[model samples]
Target: MRVFFSTLALCLTASFAQAQCGGSFSGFVNGLKDEAASRGHDRQSVDQFFGSVRQDPKVIAADRRQGVFQLPFTDFARRLISSGRINTGKSKARQYDAVFDRIEREFGVSRGVLLAFWAFETDYGSFQGDFNTLNALVTLSHDCRRPELFRPQIFAALKLFENGDFDPRRTTGAWAGEIGMVQMLPQDILDNGVDGDGDGHVSLKTSAPDALMSGGKMLQHLGWRAGEPWLQEVSVPDNLDWSQTGLRTTKPAAEWAAKGVTPRHGQIAGTLPASLILPQGRKGPAFLAYPNFRVYFEWNQSFTYVLTAAYFANRLEGGPVFDAGNPEQGLSGEQMKRLQQKLSQRGYDVGEIDGILGAGTRAAVQDVQQQLGLPADAWPTPALLNAL
Candidate 1:
């Protein structure tokens, strides 16, 4: 109720923004008319459609909030792995083993990553959000902060309506107007929604298969590699170029071996390019990642998220817990960046030497630590800096 009232108030204030320009309703009706003529839609239905879409401010605010988010990786990981999410992920993973296996086999993306996303985005679709997508986008588009960015989405929603794809009054979605189970935005619905229930129409909402498959398709489109693990737990030796094993770029397994780094499991079986990643200061789990890990990066660029996702996936696979007992001392963001900068000066690329300790920076730090004959946890410290 609060959301609805807030939306109404925003529209009342902003009515002048559009009502003055021959009115929002008139413009909407006109656009529908063009769409109707193009697709042979009747005039009355078009008018009805135009009347149905109202501006939604709550959703706009929601989108605005999500757009500028920055949470530390550790914090993000802990939040996603809440007890509720873990149990839910486990249950869903077992229940959908067939679908997951097929998707895994075909896409090379593990079911755990898929499941984790489902858990995160909408809590296994329980909190898919509630809002009228068209209204929100249309309202936001007219809000003036960035109309050019949202106007097309509103238009797209209208196109969907005018085409009889979904009734405007009945179609609802997330606060930012993400539809159906996967909470896909309107553009994604247009491009990737599928008729998972054997219905002629494709929808992101109301169909579990449709939503999950749409998400899977997005993963595949994002460069998911088949037949490769996203990550692997590795034994970072007491001394090695551990930092160079970052996903910022590639290094061959043999190159890593030359630095005295060995996998906890054994020597890597092939010449696959891998990156070193240490998520928890030097005291925590270290990972060897393949190209597929980059795919996880594509979905959401958080070293913490990808690492935890991989760990959760490992749990799903019955893999052992990380043998590294504790996190090495953590580096402050400033100290970490300086460490990264030093590594870059020494010919290791840690990606911009940013204060953020992303996988690239960690790998660069590892390389320096190994060269210095220090334990290569990739968690740089003042002591390490003092030696430099």
Candidate 2:
């Protein structure tokens, strides 16, 4: 849910034909005033600003779009790192080289990763969404769907108003409450965004310099390491506990090489530790993902989302493909559930037998595969099902 943008815009102000929410909104303003006062913030302006809020159901539905329910890895990756994005990234690589270089030098982060984020967030400032941030957030907070998570963000948005991050009158973003060219959440914008242009203010929407540097600063804050590949194609070693290694902890490059793994580019930064992972399945590209790469995953939990960002970063850097070979058919949702149940029955301790294949389930599947003396791919297949 990292990349969700938390864009749950329950537009409390959109002119939908729903029941009149003016009373409810007025109550909310009263509550916000009390809350702000309790928090040592000025209550007058906060009340005035929140005086005219309403619920936007359209935003809620949009946030819950089925496209995100079970997006295929291949398709998600394609949508993110498209040809247009790559081309633009290349141009930006040159256009903003000075800024990027300075950022990279200061932060020890990769320009490509930072630029990829900027590109993915708002198409390098091409089209920031036109939704009203305050309206959307206020609506989401009132709605019970994610009130706890969103309510705090709404408060943070108010703080932004208090501190003058942007003019509340014209600040806009995605349907949810993300703003600017990089689509920063208000909370993150407050905490991480830096004034890169030195213009005495930071605005991600109108300042490419500020947006890019803020993005880079975020990666730095997230623990990016310089002179290290975010991720790299690697040969999965024989008998390696591939499942446990994935996104759990990284192993030293030499240890992986000792287990028959080898960097595809032979530029093994040998000093860094990497987590071995098989994205889709066996016979697919194997990657030893670095910590910074894992940080990208922190931003977007989807493997495909992070992979696309990293892959696009590489594309921007003129890096080669990480294709391992022929990939296998990924497990469908039902199949994944079945696999989880089977693993649980065999005593793997998957949290629940629900079809959601998470880290625990994948690790358990690997354990089952190892015990069964399979190819050790850790993939759920008909044959593996037959074993049960």
Candidate 3:
């Protein structure tokens, strides 16, 4: 009877998901329009908001092709941070010196962090993407993968439309429906948008000052400490405990110091809490991630991407390049999937077995390594897979 009920529950869940996700596209759109009107949005405004909305297959394609995220931190960071991008970031910082200064003063967000994001997201507004904003949002909302997250943004976009800020026929941006220079969603703009140029409108796309200030405000809203460091490159002793590494474990800076964790440069706060992150394992580059570093995850969830962006922010502030030490090669996508399967079978919740070395998978690997008396460095290897 228990097995029968579980099967029935599974069937019900599949049916419910189908009802919410894979139905008629026109009906899904019409339901959205009805919701807007019900929420007291003007009929004309609602009609105009979704007028040109059409499913963009390209957006869906872009969403699925995020395989670049599967790459190791070293390779991914190398692809993103370049001398040319760094130079351009410096130039932009100087050009908008006054704006950045004001942003730092008002929002307590440093120019280096915002500049790194601006450089990476749209290359200093060189390309903010060319997809239709409304189409992208509506299409993603109608799709099954992440409707709950995207559906509300459609309404937020409508609010922007009502305020004369967004255009369904135009307003191109990232395929994820984020707009303007820093690539923010409509909801984020509504909540944290700023008029840094004093133009009475929060125009993030065309206005550099507005984008920088708005991005700064958003970071502050995401729990950025007023005057604290985020990422700092550090050196760890060879005999340091491997299980103590990873983001899950944190110790006071003094405690880490006691463990022979030395800053590659300046001193870390003695009392401040920090996590020793061995992104490519203990053999590779290491960083002491502070409280402010957690905010980067709120910005972007990819572990490697967040680390790279934070490190780039440090670089913009004159931080030195990292030393890429020799590390063992990690498991490929298939091997990772197999490892995740084994971990899950042993009662570890490794989130989707998508073959990405995410935090969950890393934690599970560390636990299994400890059990097998192996180095719990959190870097998956072929030997670990064989042991499993």
Which prediction has the highest TM-score against the true structure?
3
> If ranked by lDDT, best first, what sequence of candidates would result?
3, 2, 1
Best candidate, lDDT-wise? 3
Tell me each candidate's TM-score. 0.67, 0.83, 0.94
Writing each residue's lDDT as its tens digit, candidate 1 over 8-62 gives 1222324233432214744754654574456665667667776767766576667
lDDT of 2: 0.70
Q: How accurate is candidate 3 locally (lDDT)?
A: 0.86
Off by over 4 Å in 2: 5-29, 237-245, 333-361, 367-378, 382-388
lDDT of 3 by residue, 19-121 (tens): 3554888889998888789889998888888778898999899877667777899998999999999999999999999999998999899999999989888
Model 2, position 208, has a per-residue lDDT of 88
What are the Cα lDDT values of the candidates?
A: 0.62, 0.70, 0.86
Q: For model 2, how does the per-residue alpha-carbon lDDT over 74-144 read when each residue is reduced to its tens digit?
A: 55666666778888888988998899898888888888887787887778888888777777877766665
Residue 171 CA displacement from its true place in model 2, Å:
2.1
Q: For model 1, what is the C-alpha lDDT against the true structure?
A: 0.62
Q: Candidate 3: TM-score? A: 0.94
Candidate 2 TM-score versus the reference = 0.83
